[model samples]
Target chain A: MSENLIPLEQLQKTCLYDSHVALGAKMSPFAGFMMPIQYDSITVEHNAVRQKVGMFDVSHMGEIFVKGPEAEAFINHIFTNDIRGYEPGKVLYGMMCYPDGGTVDDLLVYREYLANHFLLVVNAANIDKDFDWIQEHAKGFDCKLDNASPRIGQIALQGPEAEKTIIEVLGYKEAADLGFYTFCDVEYNGERLILSRTGYTGEDGFELYTTNENIVEIWDKFLKAGVQPCGLGCRDTLRFEAGLPLYGDELSPEISPVMAGLGMFCKYEKDFIGKETLLDQKAGNLEKKLVGIEIEDKAIPRAGYPVETPEGEEVGVVTTGYHSISLDKSICFALVKKEYSALDTPLCIRIRKKVFPGKVVKKRFYQTNYKK
Target chain B: MSKILDELKYSESHEWVKVEGNIAYVGVTDFAQKEMGDITYVDMPEEGDDVLAGEEFGALESVKASSELISPVSGTVVLVNAELEDAPEKVNEDAYGAWIIKVEMSMPSELDKLMDAAAYKKMIGE
Candidate 1:
């Protein structure tokens, strides 16, 4: 049967399901998995990461492995980022796009311990579609592709104190020395685990990739140590505050990385899928671009709200928005007409029956505190 | 489990009306506020605006989404809860006490169409 026909009640659950329930988490279905939306509260969970340390069960994220002598070439053919000289244990954040430059999914490609073997972490919602796309394009690549999503479990330990917490709680002291965007394999309970200094919250953190049983053990250790168990609700707000792009919201099939102000990740030197169209968009007059808007009123600007010019011309729509928990301002990321996306451009957000005045500003609402 | 006042009339939309002769006080029910979670803003109609029965008068915004506030009786808005503009959390704290608006009933008989507290409880599966 097709994926869509699957019933909502039959949604998958991560290995940490019982832990979340025991902690009084509000469970909701997201990306085909029954995930925790909030544990104590969104505000509390969000502040925990911003102030101290928190862990998120990111097990629902899919992991696909590609291995062969031609793995790097095959990855370069599908990915926008240039990974030709990437050393083992390096991680590159990039997108896989359709031939027409539309996004398939924004993902992280991790060079594994073994040479010529790489792991791709993709959004859970796009697992089947992305795997199918990868297989369809791998016909002539002389590489093997394996969907290892179900077998892999992931957790992100995030915040300023994440390094200390990981060392004290999980007994993974080597995590402290791992460079940003880099991963290393460490033995845990007689099994190898991948620990990477990467996170979506733009904080100093590390993500752990392991088996379900090991992940459960790690979660128990964190729980025993009083590390905050964050849910998807705060995960979004934290990532939003850090100006990270969510796949569906910021980079969709219609919204390319370039249009989303993520052109840096799209290396033009590499000949990949949609490279021609991306180069054309970079050189030519683009129609729309992503920008940040700050409203003067306390009234929040939410997703799908219409963005208009002072003269009432519809220019864009909000993809994600919130009365930011940390900043305490009503801000949003909007895809607006190219001409109207410049900083300090006065705009109006049509929310409900009234139009509130706003100004286009830097997309990064809050400064990120990543340990370089 | 939210408290339902027996004296108040309820709308299917989860608004409560405390009628006093021809004038009625309108507010979202406790159950509504509980479901909304962390009320951030309450958009209310200005005084003297006509609010038709069973029509959207304004909206109540929570942290996650916005919910439309439907008027249970046809009336002209006489007073809005101005405090809600700055302190919307009052609705979440005390949904029954934080009345949203006061309306002069144009069709007093519209109250007949509303459910009593007992009916409202049953409707909510309480």
Candidate 2:
């Protein structure tokens, strides 16, 4: 069920590990954790999140807390998004880039507690590296940094019926009032729970974060409520269909936000790291650009497959490709040269000695149903 | 547990062979089809092509990944399953029924080395 064959003892398990096992989930290593890839089938799970509702054990995601008088300034210095005037309950999505304009990580910043406090949710695999990187840049800041990932657990209840499920099953009354990308702190069993109308699946949903002790019970209630148990496999498909970027695939150290067409999220008026480089990129100084392509045939284009022009000259490689479950067509994200990045541009993807024709299209392959 | 047919012979690479006279019908076993979810495409060798035993003759593309389809018995391809060219999901529906190719065996004696239904089941830990 796993690829790398890491020592079983070394793989970390989530709070709902036993529950996943008992449900006969196909477990695989993901971000150093024994994560469920699927419970029944990838097709079934992917359709559930797109058509109905599904829940993901997103506990492996990193949660870092920043506090102190210098919190806002320090975060603004490192973050691409300007959070200086952010309201306490506001949430912002952006990236932390290196000085050379390479991506460090894309993250979400949530301000909920006080004027000087914020929660940074990051990818699980980069927890240690991100913490150290943030700490290194935080040498002169007076803010206190806490890597609270090990103590926190999260669940993303997603679909059109998310609010109803959260109300009827989990009984979180605040879900009905929360706006997209916004969260409210709720007290459950004397423990603070952060419930937000945020999701990666491009659906109307809510993400709840709480202590590890509270997560298992919350998961049980969802399980008993018959919420479809989704895994990382479908989570990927749903997010891909939504045009949401995955860190490792879409954004990496070499693939900057501007290159990935995410420059809109980067506020350039501030003095953040990599601001100058990104600004230069925005002014037509970029080379390879990420674009969406639709394959004209049944051949599936996969990552690392060379994308070529009509003359067979290699342009770039596929970053992520799939037979989109919702659209019922073959589409992929590729980083091709600027000349071939425009819509309706013709490109070819070579899969195992066979070159398939494709055309560039909008990145958002499926219409999202996010509740405003 | 995966299904096993008494009339079919199996290879360790998870392919099944149904012999009819000198022709061997080749397809992926139930275990292989189930493990590879949602077959999307099937790359097959053209008719009259020589297929070597234990060599990759084609590929099975699924939603998750593309897996190589190894030939269990070496022979010249008699016919390619044209139906799978557009309807690859037939394998997911019925692995044994969805024969990928029919080969006129160059070495029909090679069938003696393959495992029957009982031995194949034991080998797959069914």
Candidate 3:
């Protein structure tokens, strides 16, 4: 069967799916679910989050809970980050790697306020794979793992005015007290809710994780408050412009963290899966480096396009590219050979039959507004 | 629902052709542009490049997807719309107004093979 002919019954729906349809959003398939691609123009929705506030129905994300006395040790064993001695309410971003130095998934590890407990928020597309990978490593550990994806729903309120919206619009006074990368569990409408000061967009924002039953009410509340509802369209451009990596594109089984320029997240002092290989790559010549390429032309470089030297020698491929709505320049994240990954190095991108001249530059095309 | 102009002829691939004497003005229809959203780039052939009926001559790229611009008539490209280089969104603003290329027809008979606005409307289930 053709990939586009996947039966409508085969796709899944979030708790707020009806709300999205009612808003006249353009629906498209994403991660085996019928997701909203856009409501208004992507550029319009993008500017809303950058300047004021916008909300997203990110209920498609996966959540897993780890409990028991050995939870911390279990996490550190599979994860690349050194999460030791971290205080409760802290959320750290890292990845799980295979024994061969391949990435399983990049996720956020939240240290729950409860003792010996943690919450793992993973990408929507990798939910099943990530759950199975974590279970496989849970062989002899004294930790209990639970995939809580089906029961959970998430909403991200993002922008400079996010906190104000939560405080004034939603009447959540405690939201103003949360710091970046910190979360607090509170009760809302007689139900349990977890509010975290974390977001995929580089903007300052809050992610509200609650029961599937309660999320519908929260989404409707935001709608009543007149907050712009953002779809996955702008969500991607925002994160890409902020230099954040998407799992399948930037980091995959073949594209290791070392090659993706994410060595900072992998601590050499820690003993974890794929640490030795990452250490070797750190001390040696990496096969490829993820760098930013900017073209003077309006032609956009997309994924799978070839990156070449000025003399027309193939160097690498673009993982993600866009005619940056914020910067008004055509920029892309390309995985080029290590020799050609330096700043101001001249390169060319083969977009279709034509080649556009460009140069390697910093990957952060748009500066993040995260609260430090 | 996409607007279908009464006079322009359309190809199965959604390109519309407006003929004046030996010259043919070619561009994507309103339906095509509406589906493509905001067009960021238009890749077109140089002036004087020959184009054949039902053959690809250029492409239109949006943020999420790319669509090929198929020619509906056989001709030599007389002019390429240079305005789209900076304002590709003009295609989305007015698909009929943003003519991507103009071709001096070498085989005017190919124009008869294209569907009139009524047939194209029925083809798109209007």
Candidate 4:
């Protein structure tokens, strides 16, 4: 009927495309970018980074700067986390929710300078929505918000050797004392950069933020210094093994953070948008509960697949699914009926045309490495 | 990788079966496991399960994906690899050594429908 191939729009390239291609990486589409899924093999790359060290291109994440006389109050009113209580150089993980209590995006709020400004790091896919949301809510406040994503370059040095790699690269003795979730200004090649002791992978790591002009030099320097070049495939497996949720699969517009097992981020004491609906749901009106299921048989649980009770009644759907390299099982996270949220409950997933039996396990299939 | 001993038969899906008298031994090809990444779980039919030629009899779970195991010939399952229950990675480590199940072939001549190692290799673009 149509001669046109429904031509796909050109994809935006990252700064590391050539580098990844040279390493014989398998590239795949992710968040609108052609990203490397694996270099040699997913398992080899995953174990290499976990046992040693690795680096990830994290420039895709969105960063915003909020500054002004009313920055503190404005941020406190918007974020679910208590921004008023955070100290300078501290980062707090939280979410921005809609008025109806649905999560817009989970973000990390970094208190930069004393009460004057702060930085917010958000997921890559939600950058536009996050920026627009902040602007729409800033009409009555005296705060100024700026989308600094394009200008900023980010890299994550992760694994057991993360601290040593970052300290050596930046040549900062004070960086050794940096605590988890804390950031500090560092001088790298005469350029001042913000280095935070935080990362998405379940490893001891640091996320470095600097100008785009200096990022290529930094990436090259890290690779030369033996920070193994890692790809997004390993990143996904590492985070999944650590039981962290990906935004598109775990955090969706229709799903609430509470239903995703992140209710601790929601605060009733704070008078913010989405409070009333969340409060009503918290009062026992919630319908579905997120549960983690591990397939007892060999069948894999995949996203969008139907999950049902042993008796064949549809209970819910799989949100995220994968085989766990660490646990040696096919694991999945599903939002099932509240009554079926019990641990160790037998369940079945309809994959293709066959029914595979599974059982609910702990939300975290693997132990997290975050320092308390 | 085991010698795809010429006596055995293969399927396009990468399964290999060796028939001796009325019994057969089944295992996946080296290419199958390597392409599937790390094997986390292997579901095998029980000792008394019935299998039909071209019908799926079991499944294999790999990191980030899952695959089905189809029968090469109609038979009754006589033995299964119980070791896979604890160490499924063995399949990835050595696919030929980790034979999934053994069966008593109903139609021994059905093996003629399968290809040899050379033919199977060509189909997968080896």
Compute DockQ for each candidate against the true complex. 0.52, 0.61, 0.73, 0.39
Instruction: Estimate candidate 2's alpha-carbon lDDT, on a 0 to 1 scale.
Output: 0.90
Q: What ranges in model 3 sit over 4 Å off? A: A1-6
User: What stretches of model 2 exceed 4 Å from their correct place?
Assistant: A1-6, B48-50, B107-113
Note the chain A TM-score of all models in turn: 0.97, 0.98, 0.98, 0.94
* TM-score of candidate 3 on Cα atoms, chains taken together: 0.97
Residue-wise C-alpha lDDT for candidate 1, range A91-178, written one tens digit per residue = 9999999877889999999998798899999999999999999999988887999998998899999999999998887687788789
Q: Give the TM-scores of the predictions, in the order they appear.
A: 0.96, 0.96, 0.97, 0.85
Tens digits of per-residue lDDT for model 3, A1-372 = 132576888988999899999999999888878899999989888999999999999999999999999999999999898788889999999899987778999999999989999999999888999999999998899999999998999999999999999888768888888889998988877888998999978899999999988899988988898889999999999999999999989999987888888988998777899988888888865788899999978888999999999999999999999989899899999999999999999999998878999999899889999877
Each model's C-alpha lDDT? Answer: 0.91, 0.90, 0.91, 0.81
* Worst lDDT 10-window in candidate 1 chain B: B57-66
- Which structure among the candidates has the greatest DockQ? 3
Residue B16 local lDDT, model 4: 88
Deviation from native of the Cα of residue A359 in model 2, angstroms: 0.9
| lDDT for each residue of candidate 2 in A260-295, tens digit (9 for 90 to 100) | 999988998789999999999889899989999998
- Residue pairs clashing in model 3 are none
Clash count, one per candidate: 0, 0, 0, 1
How do the residues A1-372 of candidate 4 rate in per-residue lDDT, one tens digit apiece?
Answer: 111322335544567777778887777666666677777677777776678888888777899999998887787777877777767999988788887777899999989955688999998778989999998887889989999998888888888777777768757666678888999887666876888989887887888888876777888888889778778878887887676778777776667777777877777777777777777777767888788998865566888899998899999999878776566577888889888988999988988667889888887877766544
**Cα shift from native, residue A46, model 1 (Å):** 1.0
Pairs that clash in candidate 2: none
